[model samples]
Target: MDCTTVSLPFEMPADACNVHLHIIDPAFPNDGKAASQIGTVETYQALVNKLRLPRAVFVQAKPFALDNACLLDAIQKFGPDNARGIAVVNNTISDQGLEQLHNGGVRGLRFSVWNPDNAVVSFDDCAPLSERVKHLDWNMQLHMGAAQLVKWADIIRRLDCKVVIDHMGRLDPALGVKDPAYPFIQEMIDKGNTWVKLSGPYLNTKTGEPWEDATRTAVAIAEFAPERVVWGSDFPHVTEKIKPDEVVLTEMIATWLPTKKARQLALADNPKELYGFV
Candidate 1:
């Protein structure tokens, strides 16, 4: 996808932030997954520049697992002022280690329960880790599918810090609001401590690009918690065999957030609060 040729249907606020994306550098050791050819700081910067988003959050990619060297390096390269990270850390991390990560611009911990065998942090680690980071004002970012959402509802409700659900709770868009897990997600949002990333429609969408099926789910989530929703490109889109055009992905924000005010909140204001971006 040529990002340069793609344009947004509506103008984004100058402070707009892409709250979800990844930067995979081969310089760091990997978890043996095939590295994405286009996953790099330079390529991501180009995409964000083309989309006019000045801020970004470097999510810990699956390939790097618990070793955050690549994630930290990307954050350093992007500059702390313009970037923050969500790292994959376990319960055994020392106080000083957590402090170092916090100082290095990591504001949250990510727990991936979607792929259990490969998940660095399991459901059992979430609560204890959340308690550990509560004083730092860090949030827990959960990357899980619909079944996991339902399976982990109790633990999710008891989390000590704020929670961010990755990829619209990984719900199947064809089911729209009727998806069994939708109510559980809505319940979490109503608690006022949970935020949802309106990202990765491609991950669950049965329909192709423009992703009309997924749009329903995204809009439903945005409407349910306008202040709690944020947008992400899911760049490099590693899980897919073919990448979706970054341009089209950026423009989809127009449909998810239909008004300038809504866009401002999701793209700019919401991220600042969620990520602690100055």
Candidate 2:
């Protein structure tokens, strides 16, 4: 959806970077990639200008795993001052190369266990890689099916660096707040190292837009760990059959939080801290 169609509930902070964005280039071969959402530095810059949110965190989409050229290029094109990235790397990468990535504005590493077609890293690599990047102060971020969160609990708990879980732990609505998964996440948050991305209600929702089920979970997270909560547009929305308008999604976040102070923290302050955005 275009920016003019909807009214934003609160004023957007000038430098707010939508926490999760993917830069897609057809020149790169994405192995197991499905969505046709093609975004580039140029289009994204226009988006930033129109939205007035000056920064963005770029996650290397699955299709381009191991080949970080596109992701790095966008970060540079967007200017490291306003763009940061989460790259996908395996043990094969060298220490100097990693330092290069860090110097180039990559602040995190990602693993996607939920979608095998898009996944490049194995469960075995989580801890080792988590250990590898700890020196850089980089967080380990991953996306997995909800139930599988239980399997990796111990590994995540042992990480020396911070961790980020996408989409409200991908919790199933059927699982009440008291479920083992939420408690595990609560435990992580209590330890002060885990942050949750309030994103993709369309990914977890059964009822569709306005996704009350996912909304409740996101709001609960904001309440439970406001400092650890951050928002994402999941821009270019590759997963959905029909993309939800970004404007509506932004409005949904504003409505969910309802107060200017809370929304500003979620949209800008918290993200600036998480991504180290200037």
* Residue 167, model 2: Cα distance from true site in angstroms: 1.3
User: Can you write out model 1's per-residue Cα lDDT over 1-278, one digit (the tens) per residue?
Assistant: 35573556998898899999999887789866635544899878777767788899999988888889888999989878999999998888999999999999999999888988877777788899899899999999999989889988999999878899999988866787788998998999899888999999888688877678889899988988899999998888887788887777888888999999999999999999999988
Q: Model 1: which ten-residue window has the lowest total lDDT?
A: 30-39
How far does residue 160 in candidate 2 sit from its true spot (Å)?
0.9
The lDDT, on a scale of 0 to 1, for candidate 2 is 0.80
lDDT of 2 by residue, 1-278 (tens): 24332346678866776878889877666664523668777876766666666788899887786888889988998888888999888888899989999998999998888877657888678788878878888888878876778888888889888889987778886553545688888998899888988888888676777788778878888888888888888878888778887667877877667677777787778887887776
TM-score of each: 0.95, 0.93
The positional error of residue 39 in candidate 2, measured at the CA in angstroms, is 1.9
- Per-model root-mean-square deviation over C-alphas: 1.7, 2.1
